[model samples]
Target: MDQTTAIIDLDLPGPRISRHVYGHFAEHLGRCIYGGFFVGEDSDVPNERGIRTDVVEALRALSIPNLRWPGGCFADDYHWRDGIGPRDQRPRMVNSHWGDVVEDNSFGTHEFMDLCELLGTDAYISGNVGSGSVAEMSEWIEYLTRADDSPMADLRRRNGRDEPWKVPFFGIGNEAWGCGGNLRVEQFASLARQYSTYVRNHAGNEVYRIAAGASDADLHWTEVLMQSFDALDRAEEADAPAGPFQAVSLHYYTMTGPWADKGSATEFSEDEWYLALERAGYMDQLLTRHGQVMDRYDPHRRVGLVVDEWGTWWNVEPGTNPGFLYQQNTLRDALVASVHLDAFHRHAERVVMANIAQTVNVLQAMLLTDPESGALVRTPSYHVFEMNTGHHDADSLDVHLQGVPTRTGEKSELPLVSASASTRGGTALVSLTNLDAQAGRTVVLDLRGRDVVGHSARVLSAPGLATHNTPEAPDAVAPVTLDAVRPHDRGLEVTLPAHSYVTVSLTLA
Candidate 1:
């Protein structure tokens, strides 16, 4: 591949990238909650109320903005009462969604909220809407956010906490058209309006309620949901105001093949590797199409599109529970993260927040959990997040790339050089990713209105897509400080390697 050119105008600005765009998702699937994050105090792992202390510190290091919890499909079956109160008294139940494994109900609402406080991240709770009554869902909200003298509030007090925990974002259900209830699109929309009505927004917590949108290219489902939003918004004119719907959420997962055989996480051919990248690049298209639908109803773009569930979904690691969805992360996963995140940065106006599926010890997790010895190792995906921290809350700058090649027809066309820029104060970050797995390209980064007096660069690249991190070899695929970065007269010239992601910071004079 020939060297490319990327031009950036530092003064050009776009919407502020929400910190929540870098949010994470932690579900009850497999060991994601049980052993992955919550290791009882008796174990060798450091813990506070069964939450692993090391994991907490790791998350804090990333300054993770928000965390969604309890379920993918498990949320629909989650009984809030069963998980509250004393751990010993909390009833056990079968997971029913992930595996037929027993759920000891040890980690509940209080523990989850406490974990959120420990990591200093906001909580995004998913309520049960499938096979559960409306009052059941409403009462759970009261237990978490209501400080009033209601019965639910009293129950929360008796359970232990005097003050209510804040819930900034809430999802009414997981996948209402599938595991959530298997209802039709219109039926889910009708049910979403009814269920969302009872979700209370108490003091100190406005509750950014997110309605579940369609899967991948299911534009009809989003249209139906928006139609419901229109009706709800119009009710205010009639003096019968309805609840607020701040955002609509869509879920997409990158799959190299069919669900039954989603190729190996650690071992795959170059074709499959490119296929994974191709699947990932489709996130941009999905957001663009979904954003267009949202604009039809929300022309002013008031409502946000939250990609609450995303990341590569692959076959479980061999010998693990098939339903657990546990997989390893490689340099390939890191590239996928950069690709999706760059998309979010470009569409900062419509795409507000996105939570990568399973923050730890599940599919595309940041940390791989060794259940036997209670050891944790950071995955390549974690390094991607750490490198991208500069994008949080920064104003986007206009970036243009030319002479870029493309990989056509796997799922979508992927450019060889993907880039995004953001500015904060006197500091500006220029990030670029080279999608070519076998060829390197030198990028002529053209800059205007900014002088790169000093700079630093961090890059994540590996020998091949099969390279990954394990407990024995944690640093096998970590970021290295690149010394090739230097400031030039025609802008900052940089060269990106095959299948690499680099972020350069320009400290203005």
Candidate 2:
């Protein structure tokens, strides 16, 4: 059988790999917090201070660098005061955006921070700028990060914790043009400025302030935001101008068509698979076009692009509330993950951080949890993260790939393989995805810059596109060590099975 040839030239290196690129998001919606990740301290699910012990072990395996919490749209509506203090004193509110279920303020600021501490990850706090006042937003920051004797800090101490926690990443709002506040570009920017100004920095914790960015292909939002920041810069010239933000965020997802009919997660046709992969590949175009618009204003690239919410969204599980985006993770979802990751690695200079939507029991989640059974299963997407761990903080290697034939259909065309590579220390990591639904690809992975001494590889796939794991069969779809990893003249070669994702860690001399 003749195999399609694809060349990977590792000679070209790009930006430094950001560890934050592999970040995850855990929103205050669905079972993500209540029953999925945090089951309360009293639960018998084997918890460490209310955080699921099993999820802790799983996330730690991937070296999860950062976690964004509290909201997608929930952040805009979240009032910090209502979530802090004694649990009995806290007020309950409806999670208006995700399921109108009354959200008991049980798992609040302290619990989330505790989870972050347990997992050893940086916390990305999405603050409220929409319905929240400047004082409310400012006080929330003061309570979390200030070690001084201020009222907010004092209140935090009285609640429980005496020491302040570090707030590394903070977003001023979320989806401002829509669920966040439905504000115009100018209005959102104005409020972002005012809210951010009141957010004080203390205890030597330099927060990476993020501006609530566009929802999908809204490139105009990015342009207006930078313009708004530029105007802010000019106004602050006399007062030692502080940079506007560390990054501006963007949100996108892969679903079967529009919101009205986001087809089933498990049930899909071949054409739907093509549509899904096509949607995933468009992340590249989104980054490229959005980056170009960002460059027009930020010529020096002082601020990077943060894809805060992204994943394959689908119709919620049967018998579940439609608003709770709980969908099963399948082999198809793993391919979607690999496709977006390749796009992120290629545009590392501009795309600094990306977080997959709702980390558990939600859209394209990494884990499916059952609080009743105390059953936890790591999803196929979870294996992809562990496989690509080599790319965290690794120097980006611009691996040029070609010669793989395209899978042409009436609606979409995807190359048989999509790949990227990075190196840290003396080892290089190459990730390749065989997006083809039927045929396997034999790729001659070329490591151009150095000679390899040895290597190891692993592949994550299943018998079918929809193959997935349930609590009863947790290991149904997991990674396997590939014996086909072989040394070529100056590089390596590997064969990828149909609908598979492979990662190679090469030892370079």
Instruction: Point to the candidate with the largest lDDT.
Output: 1
For 50-158, candidate 1 gives per-residue lDDT tens digits of 7898899888888999999887799998888899988889999999889888998898999999999999999999888886888998898888998888898899899
Tell me the number of clashing residue pairs for each predicted model: 0, 0
Candidate 1 lDDT score at position 427:
89
Give candidate 2 regions above 4 Å deviation. Answer: 2-6, 9-12, 231-242, 409-412
Clashing pairs in 2: none
- Tell me the tens digit of each residue's lDDT in model 2 across 255-321: 8768888888888987788788888998998999999998877666777799999999898888887
Give TM per candidate: 0.96, 0.96
After superposing all C-alphas onto the true structure, candidate 1 shows an RMSD in angstroms of 2.3
TM-score, cand. 1 vs. native: 0.96
